[model samples]
Target: MAAVLLIESAMKFAIAVFSAAHAPSSRRALLFAQAALAGGHEIVRLFFYQDGVYNASDAVVTPQDETDLPKQWRTFITEQNLDGVVCIAAALRRGVLNTEEAGRYQRDAVAVSAPWELSGLGQLHDAVQDADRLICFGGA
Candidate 1:
């Protein structure tokens, strides 16, 4: 009799965060992203929508006694070289902008930069198409 072998395949995932930076949902999403990468899974994109755009904002300041989830997210995205996108409309509404956006809006400063791209819903749609699964955290 021949022995059978079983192998698990790595899955491609698209993560969508819809919670604020200080929210528990965002933290869970970050942890999930880390675990997914450690498990040898691929993260196609990290989409920040609605309140989640705050996580991509450089202006977000963490309390001295609290965890800086935004900074952690930025570091993770930078180190892993992942596609981190924030919804332009949502970001604009929330006052989070990149250099280009800031200039376009005649703003004095840029709230988002490297490792965080300000784009549209199309990016999330594209990521979903390329990923095997779409994991979303925090939404009403």
Candidate 2:
């Protein structure tokens, strides 16, 4: 029989990855998130950089019967109480920023959210340094 511990106090996990587009990988990333929670480990932070930043866009409208990426991300973060930060430098170059960034750059009609804050690449280093285990999925 497989032993399943019911509680954990020291596990810290951080997920840093590229955009979870297309099949297989995207599905696996989501499944992995669920598995991490079930194993009594904590998801410390989830950072999406480069193309990965697109995963946090609020205006990603999929076809009918398609997965709503932003909603799924918000639900996971909200339920797990995890920090989800989309790298601001990456987002800015890719054109995904918050209200403050828009004002700073003097632009309009940006597609981002408060749930996913625009931060610098340094945040990733901070998260990785703080987490016990950091898993990176996908590529730039």
Candidate 3:
């Protein structure tokens, strides 16, 4: 029936995160993402904005007793082959840079790597246009 088809349909989600990796917001976002995927929903993209850029930074070191949310994010994104984008302006301001960005800015270090992309807001806009739902977490 149409109702059963509708109930079984999978949605495409765009997740926007605006908190640091150690923050509860980021953890909640991660859990939501996991649940969404497990429920057969597709993640169109993961957008990291403001402090959320820290979730994609390779330079972020977690305390020994704490969960490494950033690392977990990286692993999940890579394993899922998901598009994970970090806002370039926010990331640069927060000292999180990919190799290309580091080279462009003449920085000697790179704080971000593969599976995480440094891009502008356009990517988020595109994801919003393509996704059926836009879930946001941790913003002022």
Candidate 4:
């Protein structure tokens, strides 16, 4: 008699985006993330750093013909229940703020939404450590 063993292939992936929200790199990163989710991979964390922090800004406006990548990302992450983290330091430097951050900085308005949270660099480190694969998308 032969016994069959079933193996689960789902992998935990941590993604980091370092490009501006309007940059091609950012779009590519979103595509990659979509594909990863479609392929049944788990996204442990989606880290927005450097100019990528702009992706979390709620004030972004694009031309009618252009894709609203940040909006798309917001919908996607919200639907998937994925952890979308914007680096606190980077986001602050770029002026992308959530309600708490806006109040802390004494800003009159907040730019980031509820689905995305502002976090420290330690979150990124923990994601890298816990994920089976760490995928970074952006240009230097």
For model 1, where is the 10-residue window of minimal lDDT? 1-10
Tell me model 1's lDDT, rounded to 2 decimals. 0.93
Where does candidate 4 stray beyond 4 Å? 1-7
What is candidate 4's lDDT per residue for 1-140, written digit by digit as tens?
Answer: 11222126778999999998899999999999999888777899999999999988888998899999989999999999999999999988888989898898899878898799999999999999999999998948
Cα error, candidate 4, residue 94 (Å): 0.9
TM-score of candidate 1 to 2 decimals: 0.93
On lDDT, the stronger of 1 and 2 is 1
Best by lDDT: 3
- Supply every candidate's count of residue pairs whose N, Cα or C atoms clash at under 3 angstroms: 0, 2, 0, 0
lDDT of 3 by residue, 75-139 (tens): 99999999999999999999899889889999988999999999999999999999999999998
- For model 1, residues 1-140, the per-residue Cα lDDT tens digits are 11222115678999999999999999999999999998778999999999999999889889999999989999999999999999999999999989999899899978999988999999999999999999999988
lDDT per model vs. reference: 0.93, 0.77, 0.94, 0.90
State TM-scores per candidate. 0.93, 0.86, 0.93, 0.92
Number of clashing pairs, model 2? 2
lDDT of 2 by residue, 72-101 (tens): 877887777778889888888888778889
The stretch of ten residues in a row with the least summed lDDT in candidate 2 is 1-10
Ranking by lDDT: 3, 1, 4, 2
